[model samples]
Target: MITLIAGGTGSVKIARGLSKTVDDLIVIPNIADNIWLHGLYICPDIDTITYGLAGVLDKGRGWGVKDDTFVFMEQMKKLGQDHWFTIGDKDLALHLVRTNFLNEGKSLSWVTEWIRKKLSVSTTIMPASDDHIETRVETQSGDMHIQEYWVKNGAELDISNIMYKGIESAKVNAKAVEFIKNSELIIIAPGNPISSIGPIISLPAIRKELESKKDNVVAISPLIGNKAVSGPASKYMQIMGIESSPFGIASYYRDIASNLVISEFDNEYENRIRMLGIHIYKTNIVMEQSQDEIILSNYILNIVNKA
Candidate 1:
């Protein structure tokens, strides 16, 4: 089985492509971006991967169901509610269902599986943990949930720290850990290393498992040159005193990954990353269209197959 550690739009795009090529693909998505809003539980990364794999994602917006209406958001706005985090009518239905299930004392893994089967998704998508670990951003303004920092404030503030609340005491999902242990290859998908993939790997058990299987782990850099493909990954990296380049990405995953996949645009960092003892694979990593996603996925698969 191929296990992909996923979060954010970039990772979801990768998941979409891999789902087509591999039947035993398992996606372990980060739940740090989850939050409670409008009295409903929202899992951004999980839902994005689900919608994407189910072939109902809004490609243009990169999240939520395709052609979803915003009537619920509009109604919230009319009621003087803070609707900065845009939740469409269709998207709200998911949050409502998740919230109800959680309130009924169902484990997050169970709820997620139900949702996946309900959508007729064949690929396995699991949360990194069933625990309530939240990504909290510490900025000059004050601490706020990652959703507020990224969505409400547009991630404009310089962050001082990122805290994964509840991670210390949280248990890694046993099934996810089992998959990581038994998988033929483990891939760290291109996403925000700090907030997206960070929380999952921060767990002691999860990190230990990856460290044990370090040689089989491959990381796809979320960066092209010094800029991120999307989101505030570059900003977060810089704020945390790490260079926002392919070299920096190599350094960040040096201890956990044996190979690093970088964009051809970042060939200048090849020697620097190699100096850190990582095998580098240079290719056109940008997935601007569906064809690009497939090409990148096939490229990675070819590398693994040859190994």
Candidate 2:
């Protein structure tokens, strides 16, 4: 069994690929991105992970369905609707079901587990907390949901602060903490440094649990060539007065993660990261177009086992 901390497309790809190589796959998805829009409870990160693992993801955009029809959206547009987020018909069904369950007071963990199993997803996925922990970006312009800043505006504004709104009240699941403590290895996948992965680790128990098992924790860098391959990691790091380089990433994981892994192209920074007292591994880190995610996952598995 392998426990993965994940959010959005990139970590979803890692989780999907790793499932093929590991039995008892346990995914700790970011719960900070959940939103209630248009009377539907939408979980963008959860759906992305579930769809990607199911092999029905729209590869091009990394979200929504493959070649999914927007007829429903077109109809709404024709009716003068001004929806900010794009939700496909099939995708809306998922949100609707989720909303109904939540309205009935079911926990997010229960609903997500139920849906994943209904879709025949063999791997087990869970949220970091059933308690709400909304990620808010305090920008110079104003406050925005993490997704609105990262997706809607393309991270154009200057960010002043970033935080998980309700994380103080969130509790790390006992099972997740147990997995973290007793697992042979724990991997922090290359997701957004702030909005995605940060929120999951902010829970007091989770952070303390990760600290307790620092020896076996390994982090994969989301940045390559000093820029994030996807999302607003670079922007957030800069806002936090931190550099967005390989060494910068290693510094962030200093005490929490004992090992920091980089890509083959970033081999030059191997020694720089090592100076931070972090064990570094140089391998191909990008799951770019035409690259095999499974093969990449296998390489990562070997690294973790060796750690």
Give the top-scoring candidate (lDDT): 1
How many residue pairs clash in all the candidates, one count each?
Answer: 0, 1
The count of residue-pair clashes in candidate 2 stands at: 1
lDDT of 1 by residue, 1-307 (tens): 9999989687988998899888799999989999988789999999999999999999899999999999988998999999899998999889999999999999999999999999999999888789899999888999999999989998788788878899988988999999999998899999999889888888888889999998899999999999999887888888778899999888988888989999888879998899999999999888988888888888888878888
Q: RMSD in angstroms, candidate 2?
A: 1.7
lDDT of 2 by residue, 1-307 (tens): 6788888786877887788888877888888998877788889888998888777889889998777877777887788875668889989888899889999999888999998988789887888788778899898879989878776787788788988888887866776677677667778889987878888888878888888888788888999978997877888888777789888888887778888778779877887788888888777778764345687778878886665
Residue 272 displacement (Å), model 2: 2.9
Candidate 1: the clashing residue pairs are none
Best by TM-score: 1
Native-referenced Cα lDDT, model 1:
0.90
Please report, in order, the local distance difference test score of every candidate based on alpha carbons: 0.90, 0.82
List ranges where model 2 is wrong by over 4 Å. 289-291
